[model samples]
Target: MVTPFQVHVHLRRHLMKELPETDDAVAQWCRDQFVVKDGLLDKHALEDTFSDKELQEIRRPVKSLLVVTSWAILVSLGALKFLHWSALLSSWKGIALSAIGLAVVTVLMQILIRFSQSERSTPAKVAPAKPKNGGEPSETRQNKEQ
Candidate 1:
Protein backbone atom coordinates (compact mmCIF):
# COMPACT_ATOMS: atom_id res chain seq x y z
CA MET A 1 0.00 0.00 0.00
CA VAL A 2 1.33 3.42 -0.94
CA THR A 3 1.13 5.88 1.96
CA PRO A 4 0.05 9.50 1.55
CA PHE A 5 3.40 10.71 2.85
CA GLN A 6 5.16 8.77 0.10
CA VAL A 7 2.85 10.30 -2.50
CA HIS A 8 3.57 13.79 -1.16
CA VAL A 9 7.30 13.22 -1.34
CA HIS A 10 7.00 11.89 -4.88
CA LEU A 11 4.90 14.85 -6.04
CA ARG A 12 7.26 17.36 -4.42
CA ARG A 13 10.32 15.74 -5.98
CA HIS A 14 8.75 15.68 -9.43
CA LEU A 15 7.29 19.17 -9.12
CA MET A 16 10.67 20.55 -8.15
CA LYS A 17 12.03 19.38 -11.50
CA GLU A 18 9.15 20.95 -13.44
CA LEU A 19 6.27 22.91 -12.01
CA PRO A 20 3.10 23.04 -14.06
CA GLU A 21 2.79 26.26 -16.05
CA THR A 22 -0.95 26.75 -15.58
CA ASP A 23 -3.91 25.64 -13.45
CA ASP A 24 -5.20 23.30 -16.14
CA ALA A 25 -1.75 21.88 -16.58
CA VAL A 26 -1.50 21.32 -12.86
CA ALA A 27 -4.86 19.54 -12.78
CA GLN A 28 -3.84 17.40 -15.74
CA TRP A 29 -0.53 16.58 -14.14
CA CYS A 30 -2.26 15.57 -10.92
CA ARG A 31 -4.73 13.36 -12.76
CA ASP A 32 -2.00 11.73 -14.80
CA GLN A 33 0.21 11.15 -11.78
CA PHE A 34 -2.41 9.71 -9.42
CA VAL A 35 -6.08 8.93 -9.03
CA VAL A 36 -8.06 11.79 -7.48
CA LYS A 37 -10.95 10.48 -5.35
CA ASP A 38 -13.85 12.94 -4.99
CA GLY A 39 -11.58 15.87 -5.90
CA LEU A 40 -9.22 14.96 -3.08
CA LEU A 41 -5.64 13.86 -3.71
CA ASP A 42 -5.31 11.45 -0.82
CA LYS A 43 -6.63 7.94 -0.31
CA HIS A 44 -7.99 8.76 3.14
CA ALA A 45 -9.69 11.82 1.58
CA LEU A 46 -9.07 14.09 4.58
CA GLU A 47 -8.47 17.83 4.13
CA ASP A 48 -5.10 17.35 2.40
CA THR A 49 -5.88 18.88 -0.96
CA PHE A 50 -5.02 22.42 -2.08
CA SER A 51 -3.13 24.30 -4.77
CA ASP A 52 -0.25 26.65 -3.92
CA LYS A 53 -2.33 29.77 -4.51
CA GLU A 54 -5.29 28.33 -2.61
CA LEU A 55 -3.04 27.61 0.35
CA GLN A 56 -1.70 31.18 0.23
CA GLU A 57 -5.21 32.59 0.18
CA ILE A 58 -6.28 30.45 3.14
CA ARG A 59 -3.23 31.55 5.14
CA ARG A 60 -4.05 35.20 4.57
CA PRO A 61 -7.31 35.11 6.50
CA VAL A 62 -5.82 32.90 9.19
CA LYS A 63 -2.96 35.36 9.66
CA SER A 64 -5.34 38.26 10.01
CA LEU A 65 -7.47 36.34 12.51
CA LEU A 66 -4.41 35.49 14.55
CA VAL A 67 -3.25 39.10 14.60
CA VAL A 68 -6.63 40.35 15.72
CA THR A 69 -6.94 37.65 18.31
CA SER A 70 -3.50 38.43 19.68
CA TRP A 71 -4.30 42.12 20.02
CA ALA A 72 -7.54 41.32 21.78
CA ILE A 73 -5.72 39.04 24.22
CA LEU A 74 -3.09 41.69 24.93
CA VAL A 75 -5.74 44.35 25.53
CA SER A 76 -7.71 42.03 27.79
CA LEU A 77 -4.60 41.29 29.79
CA GLY A 78 -3.84 45.00 30.13
CA ALA A 79 -7.37 45.67 31.37
CA LEU A 80 -7.19 42.81 33.83
CA LYS A 81 -3.90 44.15 35.19
CA PHE A 82 -5.74 47.01 36.90
CA LEU A 83 -7.92 44.57 38.87
CA HIS A 84 -6.80 42.42 41.79
CA TRP A 85 -5.90 38.80 40.90
CA SER A 86 -8.74 37.51 43.06
CA ALA A 87 -11.26 39.81 41.41
CA LEU A 88 -10.14 38.81 37.94
CA LEU A 89 -10.44 35.14 38.75
CA SER A 90 -13.85 35.56 40.38
CA SER A 91 -15.33 37.38 37.39
CA TRP A 92 -17.53 35.03 35.31
CA LYS A 93 -17.41 37.32 32.28
CA GLY A 94 -13.62 37.33 32.35
CA ILE A 95 -13.57 33.53 32.58
CA ALA A 96 -15.96 33.21 29.64
CA LEU A 97 -13.91 35.57 27.52
CA SER A 98 -10.74 33.66 28.32
CA ALA A 99 -12.40 30.38 27.37
CA ILE A 100 -13.62 31.80 24.07
CA GLY A 101 -10.20 33.23 23.30
CA LEU A 102 -8.54 29.87 24.03
CA ALA A 103 -10.97 28.06 21.78
CA VAL A 104 -10.35 30.45 18.89
CA VAL A 105 -6.59 30.14 19.28
CA THR A 106 -6.86 26.36 19.36
CA VAL A 107 -8.88 26.27 16.14
CA LEU A 108 -6.48 28.64 14.39
CA MET A 109 -3.52 26.51 15.46
CA GLN A 110 -5.21 23.41 14.02
CA ILE A 111 -5.82 25.16 10.71
CA LEU A 112 -2.21 26.30 10.51
CA ILE A 113 -0.98 22.80 11.31
CA ARG A 114 -3.23 21.18 8.70
CA PHE A 115 -2.25 23.60 5.90
CA SER A 116 1.45 23.31 6.69
CA GLN A 117 1.40 19.62 5.80
CA SER A 118 2.14 18.35 2.28
CA GLU A 119 -0.35 16.98 -0.27
CA ARG A 120 -1.05 13.31 -0.98
CA SER A 121 -2.16 11.28 -4.03
CA THR A 122 -3.46 7.73 -3.98
CA PRO A 123 -6.41 5.70 -5.23
CA ALA A 124 -9.31 5.16 -2.83
CA LYS A 125 -10.16 1.56 -2.09
CA VAL A 126 -13.71 0.24 -2.43
CA ALA A 127 -14.83 -2.51 -0.11
CA PRO A 128 -16.80 -5.51 -1.38
CA ALA A 129 -20.47 -5.82 -0.51
CA LYS A 130 -21.35 -8.07 2.40
CA PRO A 131 -23.31 -11.25 1.81
CA LYS A 132 -27.03 -11.00 2.55
CA ASN A 133 -29.05 -13.75 4.30
CA GLY A 134 -25.75 -15.64 4.76
CA GLY A 135 -25.72 -16.27 0.99
CA GLU A 136 -24.49 -14.44 -2.11
CA PRO A 137 -23.62 -10.74 -2.04
CA SER A 138 -26.05 -8.09 -3.25
CA GLU A 139 -24.38 -7.75 -6.67
CA THR A 140 -24.55 -11.47 -7.31
CA ARG A 141 -28.17 -11.59 -6.16
CA GLN A 142 -29.06 -8.70 -8.47
CA ASN A 143 -27.33 -10.38 -11.39
CA LYS A 144 -29.25 -13.60 -10.78
CA GLU A 145 -32.56 -11.68 -10.69
CA GLN A 146 -31.69 -9.94 -13.95
Candidate 2:
Protein backbone atom coordinates (compact mmCIF):
# COMPACT_ATOMS: atom_id res chain seq x y z
CA MET A 1 0.00 0.00 0.00
CA VAL A 2 2.74 2.41 0.99
CA THR A 3 4.82 1.50 -2.06
CA PRO A 4 1.99 2.08 -4.52
CA PHE A 5 0.88 5.23 -2.72
CA GLN A 6 4.42 6.59 -2.79
CA VAL A 7 4.65 5.88 -6.53
CA HIS A 8 1.39 7.76 -7.01
CA VAL A 9 2.81 10.74 -5.12
CA HIS A 10 6.00 10.64 -7.19
CA LEU A 11 3.99 10.53 -10.41
CA ARG A 12 1.96 13.55 -9.28
CA ARG A 13 5.14 15.48 -8.54
CA HIS A 14 6.51 14.48 -11.92
CA LEU A 15 3.33 15.62 -13.62
CA MET A 16 3.64 19.09 -12.11
CA LYS A 17 7.00 19.66 -13.85
CA GLU A 18 5.98 18.21 -17.22
CA LEU A 19 4.43 19.86 -20.31
CA PRO A 20 0.70 19.95 -21.07
CA GLU A 21 0.93 16.93 -23.39
CA THR A 22 2.67 14.97 -20.67
CA ASP A 23 0.10 16.23 -18.17
CA ASP A 24 -2.68 14.86 -20.34
CA ALA A 25 -0.97 11.49 -20.52
CA VAL A 26 -0.44 11.38 -16.78
CA ALA A 27 -3.99 12.50 -16.07
CA GLN A 28 -5.38 9.85 -18.36
CA TRP A 29 -3.29 7.20 -16.63
CA CYS A 30 -4.46 8.35 -13.22
CA ARG A 31 -8.07 8.28 -14.34
CA ASP A 32 -7.73 4.76 -15.67
CA GLN A 33 -5.65 3.39 -12.82
CA PHE A 34 -7.16 5.07 -9.79
CA VAL A 35 -10.66 6.13 -8.93
CA VAL A 36 -11.02 8.70 -6.21
CA LYS A 37 -14.55 9.57 -5.19
CA ASP A 38 -15.54 12.08 -2.54
CA GLY A 39 -12.24 11.81 -0.66
CA LEU A 40 -12.26 8.03 -0.90
CA LEU A 41 -11.09 5.49 -3.45
CA ASP A 42 -13.44 3.81 -5.90
CA LYS A 43 -12.90 0.06 -5.62
CA HIS A 44 -13.57 -0.78 -9.27
CA ALA A 45 -11.07 1.75 -10.60
CA LEU A 46 -8.47 0.57 -8.13
CA GLU A 47 -8.97 -2.99 -9.33
CA ASP A 48 -8.28 -1.93 -12.92
CA THR A 49 -4.62 -1.13 -12.18
CA PHE A 50 -3.37 -4.69 -11.80
CA SER A 51 -3.68 -7.99 -13.61
CA ASP A 52 -4.50 -11.28 -11.87
CA LYS A 53 -0.91 -12.13 -10.98
CA GLU A 54 -0.21 -8.72 -9.54
CA LEU A 55 -3.43 -8.85 -7.54
CA GLN A 56 -2.44 -12.21 -6.10
CA GLU A 57 0.97 -10.85 -5.09
CA ILE A 58 -0.76 -8.04 -3.24
CA ARG A 59 -3.32 -10.35 -1.64
CA ARG A 60 -0.63 -12.63 -0.22
CA PRO A 61 0.74 -10.08 2.25
CA VAL A 62 -2.72 -8.73 3.09
CA LYS A 63 -3.93 -12.25 3.89
CA SER A 64 -0.85 -12.86 5.99
CA LEU A 65 -1.37 -9.60 7.84
CA LEU A 66 -4.97 -10.50 8.53
CA VAL A 67 -3.99 -13.91 9.84
CA VAL A 68 -1.26 -12.46 12.03
CA THR A 69 -3.52 -9.69 13.33
CA SER A 70 -6.25 -12.20 14.14
CA TRP A 71 -3.75 -14.31 16.06
CA ALA A 72 -2.54 -11.29 17.97
CA ILE A 73 -6.11 -10.36 18.89
CA LEU A 74 -6.83 -13.86 20.06
CA VAL A 75 -3.69 -13.90 22.17
CA SER A 76 -4.59 -10.60 23.71
CA LEU A 77 -8.05 -11.90 24.51
CA GLY A 78 -6.57 -15.05 26.01
CA ALA A 79 -4.29 -12.99 28.20
CA LEU A 80 -7.25 -10.90 29.30
CA LYS A 81 -9.19 -14.07 30.08
CA PHE A 82 -6.33 -15.36 32.20
CA LEU A 83 -6.00 -12.09 34.03
CA HIS A 84 -9.73 -12.09 34.69
CA TRP A 85 -9.85 -15.67 35.91
CA SER A 86 -6.84 -15.11 38.18
CA ALA A 87 -8.14 -11.77 39.44
CA LEU A 88 -4.78 -10.21 38.68
CA LEU A 89 -6.28 -7.20 36.86
CA SER A 90 -9.03 -4.81 37.80
CA SER A 91 -11.58 -3.71 35.18
CA TRP A 92 -9.64 -0.54 34.40
CA LYS A 93 -6.38 -2.46 34.21
CA GLY A 94 -7.93 -4.99 31.86
CA ILE A 95 -9.17 -2.28 29.56
CA ALA A 96 -5.80 -0.56 29.63
CA LEU A 97 -4.00 -3.81 28.85
CA SER A 98 -6.28 -4.51 25.89
CA ALA A 99 -5.76 -1.03 24.49
CA ILE A 100 -1.98 -1.25 24.92
CA GLY A 101 -1.87 -4.67 23.34
CA LEU A 102 -3.87 -3.48 20.35
CA ALA A 103 -1.69 -0.41 19.94
CA VAL A 104 1.51 -2.45 20.10
CA VAL A 105 0.29 -4.97 17.54
CA THR A 106 -0.94 -2.31 15.13
CA VAL A 107 2.29 -0.30 15.37
CA LEU A 108 4.48 -3.35 14.94
CA MET A 109 2.51 -4.53 11.93
CA GLN A 110 2.74 -1.13 10.27
CA ILE A 111 6.46 -0.87 10.94
CA LEU A 112 7.18 -4.32 9.57
CA ILE A 113 5.13 -3.77 6.44
CA ARG A 114 6.62 -0.33 5.83
CA PHE A 115 10.14 -1.67 6.28
CA SER A 116 9.54 -4.46 3.79
CA GLN A 117 8.01 -2.09 1.25
CA SER A 118 10.81 0.48 1.61
CA GLU A 119 13.38 -1.87 0.15
CA ARG A 120 11.29 -2.37 -2.97
CA SER A 121 10.29 1.29 -3.29
CA THR A 122 13.80 2.77 -3.50
CA PRO A 123 16.30 1.62 -6.08
CA ALA A 124 20.02 2.40 -6.03
CA LYS A 125 20.81 5.56 -8.01
CA VAL A 126 23.76 5.43 -10.40
CA ALA A 127 25.22 8.66 -11.65
CA PRO A 128 26.15 8.60 -15.33
CA ALA A 129 29.91 8.38 -15.88
CA LYS A 130 31.65 11.49 -17.24
CA PRO A 131 33.48 11.16 -20.58
CA LYS A 132 37.25 11.14 -20.35
CA ASN A 133 37.50 13.91 -22.99
CA GLY A 134 34.94 15.89 -20.96
CA GLY A 135 32.90 17.47 -23.80
CA GLU A 136 29.64 15.54 -23.97
CA PRO A 137 28.87 11.92 -23.14
CA SER A 138 30.09 9.42 -25.81
CA GLU A 139 26.50 8.63 -26.84
CA THR A 140 25.78 12.27 -27.73
CA ARG A 141 29.04 12.61 -29.64
CA GLN A 142 28.27 9.47 -31.56
CA ASN A 143 24.84 10.83 -32.53
CA LYS A 144 26.48 14.07 -33.83
CA GLU A 145 28.99 12.03 -35.90
CA GLN A 146 26.16 10.20 -37.65
Candidate 3:
Protein backbone atom coordinates (compact mmCIF):
# COMPACT_ATOMS: atom_id res chain seq x y z
CA MET A 1 0.00 0.00 0.00
CA VAL A 2 3.02 2.33 -0.07
CA THR A 3 2.46 5.33 -2.35
CA PRO A 4 5.01 6.45 -4.95
CA PHE A 5 5.79 9.64 -3.05
CA GLN A 6 6.50 7.64 0.09
CA VAL A 7 8.82 5.42 -1.93
CA HIS A 8 10.60 8.49 -3.26
CA VAL A 9 11.18 9.90 0.22
CA HIS A 10 12.32 6.54 1.60
CA LEU A 11 14.82 6.08 -1.21
CA ARG A 12 16.15 9.56 -0.63
CA ARG A 13 16.65 8.89 3.06
CA HIS A 14 18.30 5.54 2.38
CA LEU A 15 20.75 7.09 -0.06
CA MET A 16 21.50 9.96 2.27
CA LYS A 17 22.37 7.45 4.99
CA GLU A 18 24.55 5.34 2.71
CA LEU A 19 26.30 8.14 0.83
CA PRO A 20 28.27 9.60 3.77
CA GLU A 21 30.98 6.90 3.79
CA THR A 22 31.57 7.30 0.05
CA ASP A 23 31.47 11.13 -0.02
CA ASP A 24 30.15 13.77 2.33
CA ALA A 25 29.32 16.17 -0.50
CA VAL A 26 27.14 13.57 -2.23
CA ALA A 27 25.41 12.78 1.06
CA GLN A 28 24.72 16.47 1.69
CA TRP A 29 23.50 16.81 -1.90
CA CYS A 30 21.06 13.94 -1.44
CA ARG A 31 19.81 15.44 1.82
CA ASP A 32 19.14 18.72 0.00
CA GLN A 33 17.28 17.00 -2.86
CA PHE A 34 13.93 16.21 -1.21
CA VAL A 35 13.07 19.58 0.30
CA VAL A 36 9.28 19.88 0.50
CA LYS A 37 7.80 23.30 -0.27
CA ASP A 38 4.21 24.45 0.36
CA GLY A 39 3.28 21.04 1.77
CA LEU A 40 4.02 19.19 -1.49
CA LEU A 41 7.04 17.26 -2.70
CA ASP A 42 9.20 19.12 -5.22
CA LYS A 43 9.05 16.17 -7.63
CA HIS A 44 10.91 17.93 -10.43
CA ALA A 45 13.73 18.95 -8.08
CA LEU A 46 13.84 15.42 -6.70
CA GLU A 47 14.12 13.90 -10.18
CA ASP A 48 16.78 16.42 -11.13
CA THR A 49 18.93 15.67 -8.10
CA PHE A 50 18.63 11.87 -8.00
CA SER A 51 18.65 11.01 -11.68
CA ASP A 52 18.23 7.67 -13.43
CA LYS A 53 21.98 7.30 -13.72
CA GLU A 54 22.13 6.58 -10.01
CA LEU A 55 19.36 4.00 -10.32
CA GLN A 56 21.06 2.36 -13.26
CA GLU A 57 24.29 2.18 -11.29
CA ILE A 58 22.48 0.39 -8.50
CA ARG A 59 20.75 -2.05 -10.85
CA ARG A 60 23.78 -2.92 -12.98
CA PRO A 61 25.56 -5.10 -10.43
CA VAL A 62 22.36 -6.90 -9.38
CA LYS A 63 21.48 -7.68 -12.97
CA SER A 64 24.98 -8.95 -13.70
CA LEU A 65 24.79 -11.19 -10.63
CA LEU A 66 21.43 -12.57 -11.69
CA VAL A 67 22.68 -13.39 -15.20
CA VAL A 68 25.81 -15.10 -13.82
CA THR A 69 23.76 -17.04 -11.24
CA SER A 70 21.28 -18.22 -13.89
CA TRP A 71 24.12 -19.51 -16.07
CA ALA A 72 25.75 -21.24 -13.10
CA ILE A 73 22.45 -22.95 -12.23
CA LEU A 74 21.91 -24.16 -15.78
CA VAL A 75 25.48 -25.41 -16.01
CA SER A 76 25.19 -27.26 -12.72
CA LEU A 77 21.97 -28.91 -13.83
CA GLY A 78 23.57 -29.98 -17.09
CA ALA A 79 26.53 -31.41 -15.21
CA LEU A 80 24.23 -33.33 -12.90
CA LYS A 81 22.34 -34.78 -15.84
CA PHE A 82 25.61 -35.81 -17.47
CA LEU A 83 26.80 -37.44 -14.27
CA HIS A 84 23.61 -39.33 -13.42
CA TRP A 85 21.54 -40.11 -16.47
CA SER A 86 19.45 -42.83 -14.88
CA ALA A 87 18.55 -40.69 -11.84
CA LEU A 88 17.50 -37.66 -13.93
CA LEU A 89 15.75 -39.63 -16.70
CA SER A 90 14.32 -42.67 -14.96
CA SER A 91 10.52 -42.29 -15.21
CA TRP A 92 8.14 -40.87 -17.86
CA LYS A 93 10.34 -41.69 -20.89
CA GLY A 94 13.40 -39.45 -21.50
CA ILE A 95 13.26 -36.26 -23.59
CA ALA A 96 9.53 -35.83 -23.08
CA LEU A 97 9.89 -35.33 -19.31
CA SER A 98 12.75 -32.86 -19.73
CA ALA A 99 10.81 -30.92 -22.37
CA ILE A 100 7.74 -30.79 -20.16
CA GLY A 101 9.79 -29.64 -17.16
CA LEU A 102 11.47 -26.90 -19.21
CA ALA A 103 8.14 -25.75 -20.66
CA VAL A 104 6.53 -25.59 -17.21
CA VAL A 105 9.46 -23.61 -15.77
CA THR A 106 9.41 -21.16 -18.71
CA VAL A 107 5.67 -20.56 -18.41
CA LEU A 108 5.89 -20.01 -14.64
CA MET A 109 8.79 -17.56 -15.05
CA GLN A 110 6.82 -15.60 -17.67
CA ILE A 111 3.82 -15.38 -15.36
CA LEU A 112 5.98 -14.28 -12.43
CA ILE A 113 7.79 -11.58 -14.41
CA ARG A 114 4.54 -10.27 -15.88
CA PHE A 115 2.91 -9.90 -12.48
CA SER A 116 5.98 -8.44 -10.73
CA GLN A 117 5.74 -5.09 -12.55
CA SER A 118 4.26 -2.09 -10.75
CA GLU A 119 0.46 -2.05 -10.68
CA ARG A 120 -1.83 0.93 -11.30
CA SER A 121 -2.35 3.26 -8.33
CA THR A 122 -5.91 4.05 -9.28
CA PRO A 123 -8.73 1.87 -8.00
CA ALA A 124 -10.81 -0.09 -10.47
CA LYS A 125 -14.08 1.56 -11.56
CA VAL A 126 -17.21 -0.39 -10.77
CA ALA A 127 -20.42 -0.22 -12.80
CA PRO A 128 -23.17 1.63 -10.91
CA ALA A 129 -26.00 -0.62 -9.86
CA LYS A 130 -29.21 -0.59 -11.90
CA PRO A 131 -31.70 1.46 -9.93
CA LYS A 132 -34.84 -0.27 -8.71
CA ASN A 133 -36.89 2.68 -10.09
CA GLY A 134 -34.48 3.39 -13.03
CA GLY A 135 -32.71 6.28 -11.31
CA GLU A 136 -29.14 7.10 -10.19
CA PRO A 137 -27.49 5.16 -7.41
CA SER A 138 -28.56 6.23 -3.87
CA GLU A 139 -25.04 7.41 -2.99
CA THR A 140 -25.02 9.83 -5.93
CA ARG A 141 -28.50 11.07 -5.01
CA GLN A 142 -27.36 11.75 -1.43
CA ASN A 143 -24.26 13.64 -2.59
CA LYS A 144 -26.36 15.83 -4.93
CA GLU A 145 -28.73 16.72 -2.07
CA GLN A 146 -25.78 17.88 0.10
Best by lDDT, which number?
1
TM-score of each: 0.26, 0.28, 0.31
Per-residue alpha-carbon lDDT of candidate 2 for residues 20-82, written as tens digits (9 for 90 to 100)? 456468778678545543223343346544223333222466788889999999998998788
Which residue segments of model 3 deviate by more than 4 Å?
1-59, 62-67, 70-75, 82-92, 120-146
Q: Please provide, for model 1 over 1-146, each residue's C-alpha lDDT reduced to its tens digit, 9 standing for 90 to 100.
A: 87565343212345465868876798898886666443445533465554443332224667888899999999889767845554645779977876787799999999999999998978888787555545767787788889
Best candidate, TM-score-wise?
3
Residue-wise C-alpha lDDT for candidate 3, range 15-54, written one tens digit per residue: 4465556446776755665453322344545554443444
Model 1 clashes, total count: 0
Candidates' lDDT values, in order?
0.67, 0.63, 0.65
Q: What is the C-alpha RMSD of each candidate to the true structure, in Å?
A: 15.2, 13.7, 15.3
Off by over 4 Å in 2: 1-80, 86-90, 121-146
- Give the Å error, residue 29, model 3: 20
**Candidate 3: C-alpha lDDT:** 0.65
Task: State the lDDT at 140 in candidate 1.
Answer: 77
